[model samples]
Target: MLMILLAIASACAYGVADFLGGAATRKAKVFRVVAISAPASLAIEGLLLPVLGARWEAGSLGWGAASGAASAFAFALLYQALSIGPMAVMAPITALVSAALPVVVGLAEGDRLSATEIAGIPVAACAILLVTVKRSAGVGRVRPKAVAVAVLAGAAIATQLIMLNQAPHDSGVAPLIVGRAVSSLIVLNAAIAVRRRIDPGRPNLGLAAGAGCLDSLANLCFLLSARHGLLSVSAVIVALYPAATIVLARAVLKERISRAQWLGLGMAALGVTLLALG
Candidate 1:
């Protein structure tokens, strides 16, 4: 139960970071944002190492690094998708794909859920879909490219979850920190090769860096939760991040949300509650 709560908190933190990251990307190059943000995150997480006193193991370090690489890919794709497309179509799709993957993996591993939890899945799905709906459009209309990128992002996200879950439980947060650092370096190098320049003068560097710090914290919480709970349940709870993003959009961006989104938010909350109970 405690783990589940931690997972929910992770989701909240991730959602906020995502929202801020996305917003930051709007005014800056995606690669630049990533390059600056990654180091910023590493610094923040490094500071927490002593306080958290997490164990360190070679295997866990490798897995954490792998997860970090996957996360870098996911965020890069997500930022690219949002750069050219509508958030209403892309965000929810990515979130759903990422959330569903761990559940599928858990099912394959024979993890069973209670009746209430089973019922909550579709409700949560529907709610997520509803929240993605923009006030400008009615049901059944979405941009295809945005959807594609979102799906790819989700796949990367799922990979992160799977790798993180596979890491040795006793291995402290070092693995995570190392993983993130390696992933960031990989993405940074890739971005440099592609763009031929590393420009850190992006308008929202501070915001992106701040978001990265939150993201690092979220990852720490998630790793802790995964160590203590069912992977599927923990993943689903953490996936409720879209709810936080939607709320942030409405509040910070002053974007008008539709009635359906509100209803979806309610359903998502209910689904998360059921998941917790299970």
Candidate 2:
């Protein structure tokens, strides 16, 4: 029950961070937004480390670094895929792959699933697709290149989660600190490399920083949840993040939520409940 609550909290945090980051990107260059966000994430992780009582061992640091690198690649590819493809299609595919891969890895690593988990996973996956379903009007044929990139991005995201889960249970939040630090450096370097391409005018610094802080919190929750529960369950619950995103969009931006999305939200709730019960 505790793990389920933590995973749900992580999903909510991730959804909010994604919304903020997406908003920031609309007004600023992607790299610039990432520059602010990544460092902010690092800062939050640093602040949380001492409170979390991290051991900071080399093994944990190595796993964290690996996760960070994968995370950077995942973000880049996801953005590229979104830029080239219909988000309605790309987002669902990426979310499904990212969520499914972690479950597969966890099972392969000898994690057993309860009957409820077996049922919940598919329900959560269907909810993910439904929640991300946007009306892609006038969009041309689906680009194969975009699909490929989205798949790769999802795989990278799965790798990041798996690597973070591999960190020693005793390491506390050290993995998150190291991961955020490495990702921050990478994002900063990317920003510098394309400085000329970034917008020169004022950017949405507040949104970017807020996104980063929320993302750090989400990571911490996911780490704790995974350590305490089955990765299969935690990953699936986290993948339901798009439901929260849609809710926020409706409440804050007054965006219209489709009937399908409303159904998806209900399904997502049901899925999480089943996972929790399992």
Candidate 3:
């Protein structure tokens, strides 16, 4: 139950972060926004690590670093794919792959789920698809290259979560610190490399920094949830993040929620209930 609650919090945080990050991208180059967000996240995590406690374990740090690298690559591929492909098609594909792979990895590593939990998985998957699909947006012709890149992005996303989950239980927020540090460096370097091409428009630092802080919170919650519960469960619950994002878009941006999205939101609620009971 506690894990489920934590996972829900993680989802909400991720949703909000994504919303803010999306807004920030309109004002600045994607890489520039990420450079700011990554370092801001690292700074917050650094501040929280002492309060959360940590152990300097090489194995844990290594896993964290690996996750960080995966995350960096995932973002790069996701942005590139989204830039060229119709988001209506690519988003659901990426979400499904990211959610599914962790479940497979967890089960293969001997994690067992209750019957109810297993039943909820498909329900949650359906919710993910419905929430992310954006049928109203109209799926344009998706290029083969974009579809392939989207899949790779999803794989990288799953790798990040799986690697983070593999960190030792006793590592505390040490893994998060290491992961943020590595990702921050990568993003910062990328921003520097392409500084000349960056848009001269004023960047929205506030939104980017807020996204970073929320992202840090999301990561911490996910780490705790994965450590306490089944990785499959944690990943699925967290993947429901798109539902939260949709809701926020409706409420804050005054965007119309598609019928499918409304249904998906309800399905997400049902799935969460089932997982919690299981």
Candidate 2 lDDT over 1-278, as tens digits, reads 99999999999999999999889888777787887888888888888867888987988999999999998898889999999998888998899999999999999999888899899889999999899888878667998999999999889888888999999999988888888888778878887988988767555999999999999999999989999998888988988888888899899999999999999999999899889889
Q: What is the alpha-carbon lDDT of model 2 when measured against the actual structure?
A: 0.89
What lDDT would each prediction earn against the true structure? 0.81, 0.89, 0.90
Clashing pairs in 2: none
Could you arrange the candidates by TM-score from highest to lowest?
Answer: 2, 3, 1
Compared with the true structure, what per-residue lDDT tens digits does model 3 show for residues 216-270? 9999999999999999999999989988888898899999988988899889999
Q: What TM-score quantifies how close candidate 3 is to the native fold? A: 0.97
Local error of candidate 1 at residue 110 (angstroms): 3.7
lDDT ranking from best candidate downward? 3, 2, 1
Best by lDDT: 3
Which pairs clash in model 3? Answer: none
Distance from true position, residue 152, model 1, in Å?
2.5
Candidate 1 residue-wise lDDT, 1-278, digit = tens: 88788888898898898798888878877777777788989999889888876667778777888898898788779777776677667777887898899989978877788887788777777776787666445335556777788899999998898898888887777777877888888888888787756454574877889888989988888888877877787887788787898899999889777788899889888988887777
User: Which stretch of 10 consecutive residues in model 2 shows the poorest summed lDDT?
Assistant: 194-203
Between candidates 1 and 2, the one scoring higher on lDDT is 2
